[model samples]
Target: MRIALAQINPVVGDLLGNADRIHAALAATEVNGKVSADLLVTPELSLWGYPPRDLLFSAAHLEQQQQALDQLQQRLHAEQLDVALLVGVAEVAPDQQHPRLFNALALVQARGWQVVARKQLLPSYDVFDETRYFRASSSPSTLSLRVNNRDWQLGLSICEDLWVDEELHGQRLVGPDPIASLIPERLDALINCSASPFSRRKGTLRHELAARAAERLQCPVVYVNQVGGNDELIFDGASFVIAPGDDTPLLQLPEFAVSTEVWTAASSTDRLEQPSRAHQQANTPDDDLEALFRGLVTGVKDYATKCGFKAALLGLSGGIDSALVAVIAAAALGPDHVQSLLMPSPWSSSGSIADALALATRLGIASQIVPIQTLMEGFEATLTPALNAEPSGITAENLQSRIRGTLLMAMANQQGQLLLSTGNKSELAVGYCTLYGDMNGGLAVIGDLYKSTVFALCHWLDSPDAGACRAELGLGGSGPLIGQAILEKPPSAELRPDQKDSDSLPDYERLDPLLMDLIEQRMSGEQLIGAGHDPDDVKRIERLFRRAEFKRRQAPPLLKVSKQAFGSGWRLPIAAI
Candidate 1:
């Protein structure tokens, strides 16, 4: 049996468009003048896209979903294509109770499409809210197809169904063991369609989980993942096929890119006994820095294009955060369409201005020098008399940031471009960012990246290994897109004279590990202190992180790259102490 893995990026809530993309991928079945595969497999929720969220509640969304299936069926019949398709969809059952939908996989053969497998595991924790919308299935599903005058029993599972092994995850997700239940079925192959989001080292975990499943079932397991950025979540689709007793994958697909490739099952020994021929076609794994870089670029590209924006603009203050964001935007939206405004305040250094221009030139992006000195003087004059004194301290510092934010917003609105926020996770976690000031934008490109990670990514982009990525993204002929001067300098906001970030917060070197302990590890302040973190810094950071809830609530949607980003998964009450 030959199967095609259609690794695609689908826009959320675009059912008609998503269906059309699937139809197109299926139509391109010829490779070197030969039909590629007899069957096609799409990612989880490939029809309506992943995490439609509350849009699932809309009647029109449900209506369009059925319409999309009808259109896909017509296209398959009209073209007289003989390929069988396994597509993920939201299956609605009218006889069910409150939540009537099931995260389902439909088998589309010559007859038509029908629900073949309903997802039994609906994960509710950490960025998943499927329990609020989907009801779980009671039994695992198996599909039998006749190929080469022999019946092939195949077990079908959704994303979380294969993830139920407590040994790999430390604990179960309060659901029945879906993978183990399939053990009695004695299947030839297992297929899992996933829309799993990317986190640090998650690809390794996915590989391990699939390997374990293959070992238990004693069959080849194929994992298909959705690729693209959907709002806060970025899916790094590293689709592959693993067989029992094999150290490497039998077949491997590309990562962080869209693909449609075929793999043929061997007839002699069920394709499990032979060593993988895919080793000759396998690609090397990306290092952590490269993964982070691709995630940022993919996040910006999808957020802007899906939201109907062709151009992007950001406030470039010659700081590392803004500089890194500018580079990412240039790579994402193209340097020609990416615009940067050097909104230098009175306190901004001349060297900073020079560094910003040099970066713009190196990236081949258009830049404008927008001085805010006059705006500062005008605002001070307009408000000082009302208070009977000039605004000073934090208020004065925030005013400078607001002036630049306003200018950037105006440009974004006037030119109809998406504004990318440049604040990093360190600033956002500690409330070092102003509410409407540095936090204003349509999307936070690197909001999940800490200051330390930001520097590391920039350094990697400048290395020789990143040359192919730079060229692929159309970046300038560059040793480094981010200038060296911007790197070696002390990190500063430049809102006030010689104002370093350390003045407001601890050095990121000492701060990021403590933050990881608190945020991802969910450690308490006392626990962090006991683990050798600075007691004073931990106490202050906890207070700051708690107090900034309201600000984060009002800020733009941030792209998620970390295990626990400040997105939909991180919920906290603002009224609490």
Candidate 2:
């Protein structure tokens, strides 16, 4: 039997649009007249979209979804298509209070939807709070049918249902295997509908888990995932099929696009194809650098599109931070809408301006050279008396950065473009970045990536056919968009004349790991020092990280690409030390 799997991305609460898109994919399959196909399946919550969030309580959202389902039933009957449809949507039960809704999947035949499988497992762990809305199904559901005049049995499962082997108990962890129960079922295949979120290296874990289950059940498994950028989450849509024997991968689909493939029971015996290597498709394996790039692109595109802004503005220091942000902005909103500003002070190096201009030329982005010497002088004259007793310390240095930042924000205000901040994770972690200066912006492009990772991504973008657009500035060659000097030169804040970043902080190789431990892992100083770091170095790094909390707190929301990031996930006291 030929089964058509529709891989699609749907917007939350847009029931009509989501249903229309589903019908369109179904129509494409119908044009072929079902042929030998007997079933068509779509991703989880494809009807109302995934994580309807609080919209589940809205009277309009629930009403529209139910109405859409009814309309779809009429269409199915009117078309007289014999194909059976399996889909996911939100359903409200008879309970009058305290969330009577459920995350459910429905099987619709020519007559009507005969079976409804409510989600048996509600996820309530890091980044998931399904327990706040859904209730677990008390029993299992099976779909029994006949295709090609033959009988077939299939078991139903949702996203969190397969991952219930682990649990939480206050501050401790618990274990109970959920997939184990489903493994003993006597069935021909198990079909899973999911709205899984994208993370680094998630595809591998997903494949391994499904393959193990298929082997245990001795049946082929079809896994479908939702794709698209929904607010803070991005679903890497790479749905595939895995057979039990030899665990051959029958098929693999594309990412960030909607496509359908036929999964034949006969082809399941014909030849199972080998799994493709990482980087074979547009986005997989979630390479740290590649994932960082995609996250930045998505953040920029969404921030711009949602806020109704068409252009972005940023001050371009000859340093790596601004250069990286510029390239990301160009890739996101296109070169035509991104602008680079070079606001050099008296201390600014000629090489810095040249490098900034060169990069702007390479990316075909417009640039304006605004000199800030007079502005800096005015601020110094006004604040010198108050600063003379303390001498030139952090305050004086911060004034210079604030001047440049003010200039960039002014440009953005005048042109109605969103300002992009260029501070990176390393500088932001050590309190080295100037608050209200370089930290002012709507969204952070690479806030989740460390400095070393940033350098790696810059080099990666220069490679051939890595999806980077050609340089239109006539600088020659389509090599990576960032200037070569930016990658090789030592990182610097450039607050004063020739100030290198390493002069104060440890080398990024040492700094990033410490920052990762402190910020991402939330490891204490004693624990980190026990891990072979120098005591003095650990104390200094800890001090920097703790002091910088105030800066990060006021900074723009970071785009999360790691298991742990600075904002909402990592909660700690700034004065804990």
Candidate 3:
């Protein structure tokens, strides 16, 4: 049997539109008036998109989901397509209860569609509230298909259902082992439909898990993942098919793009001993930098388009963080659609101004100078009487930042563009940013990236390895998109004279590791000190992180590229001790 893995991008809450995308993918599988694949599988929750969130509670929205299924089925029948399509949908439960839906897959064929499987694992951890919406199924689901006078048994599972390997994940979800349950049935293949979000090196873990499952089930495993940015989550569609006993994938799709490819079951038997083209590509040393860059680009592109913003705006301070964000915006929205405001203050250096302009020119993005020195003086003069003294030191620095932020917002509002905040994760973690100043924007472009990561990604963009990716992103003539001047220079906000980031926070090289341990690993100050981090530094950084909670709560939504981000996944309270 030939099964087609349709890696698609679905818009959250766009039920009918998502259905059309699925149909378009199905249509692509047709050849000479005949469907090329016996069955096609899409990502989980493809109809209404993943994590529809509160939209799932709307009765009309649920009703529209049924209408969408009917429309898709009608389209298939009208096209006279003989292939069976498996799509994800929210199945209404028979008994009325608190959680009224089952995350399910429906088999749509010539006759119609039916719920073939229900997800058994409802993940309720970070970034997921599935338990609040869905009830777990009791057992595994398998479907029997007869093609060419032969019967094939296929095991069906959803995203979290296949993530039950305690050894691989280091921790297991409290639920039935879907892979183990299928072992007794002796399935032909196991299909996992997922909408898994991308994080650094997450694709590698996914490949390992699938390989493990294929080995245990003793069958080929086809994994289909959702692609595109849905809000803060970026899904890298690194879908693949793995044969039993082989860790290498028989077929692997590209990352961060929509793809559909048919894998013949018979071919896997013949090529078990030989490494496939995908395996060869996979073996070629993985570039985490390239993946990271692509993931961020995908996030920005989809966020802007999905949120109905045609252009992007940002304040370019000739600093690394803003420069990186400018590059991302130019790549995501075309250079013509991306604009920048060079908000130079009295403290802004000439070389920094020159660097920002040169970088903007190289990127082909429009840049306008919006000097804030006069505005800074005006604010100080006006607030002197109210304060009984002129705003000085930190207050003065923040006033400058706020002035630039206000100008960016004004331009964005006038142009109907998205204002991309340029704060890095290190700054956000250490409370180095002002609440409504540098933090004001509709979307935080690199808020999840550490300062060190920002520098590294910039260096990678200038490297030879990024040639293909640069071309793909339409970044032209980039010897060094972000020049050495901006890169080698010390990190600064330019809010005060010769003010360096190190003045307020630890060097990113030292601080980033500490922040990673505290935020991503959930380590306490004592744990950090025990891990050999400086005791005083740990306490100070921890205090700053906790104090910054209120700021993060009010900051714009940041794209999540890490296992833990300051977005929906990080649920720390602002009032916490």
- The per-model lDDT (C-alpha) reads 0.85, 0.73, 0.88
- For each candidate, give its TM-score against the true structure: 0.97, 0.86, 0.97
Alpha carbon deviation, residue 472, candidate 2 (Å): 15
Model 1: how far residue 428 lies from native, Å: 0.3
Instruction: Give the per-residue lDDT of model 1 (tens digit) for 1-577.
Output: 7777888899999899998887766766677755567778899888889989888788999899888888887777776777678888998887958798989988876568888999998988878999999999989899887776877788999999988777887766776777888899888789999999988788888889999999999888888899999988998888888888776777777778887777776652546666456422355346877777888889899888888999999888777888899889988988999999998887899999999999889887899998889999998999999989897899999999898889889999999999999998888888899987889999998889888998988888888878877887788445877768988889999989988999989899999999889888999988999999999999899999998888988878999998899989988887997
Candidate 1: where are CA atoms >4 Å away? 32-34, 267-269, 275-280, 476-478
Comparing candidate 1 with candidate 2, which one achieves the higher lDDT? 1
Q: List clashing residue pairs in candidate 1.
A: none
lDDT of 2 by residue, 1-577 (tens): 6667777778778898887877777776654464334777788888877767788778888789777777777787888777777888776777876557778898876687744687877766556667677766767767777887776777778876655422221132233344566666666777888888766666766776777667777676778888776655667678877766644466777654577666765432232343222212342433555555665676677667756789999888888888888888887788899998888877778888888898898888899998878887888787778766432668878888888888888888999998988877888888888888989887777777788878887887776544432333232345657868777778877778878888899989988888888776678889999877778889898888878888888887766666666655556676665
- State the lDDT at 288 in candidate 2: 54
In terms of lDDT, the best-performing candidate is: 3
Q: Which candidate do you rate higher for TM-score, 1 or 2?
A: 1
* lDDT, candidate 2, at 204: 68
Q: What does candidate 2 score on TM?
A: 0.86
Distance from true location, Cα of 383 in model 1, Å: 1.2
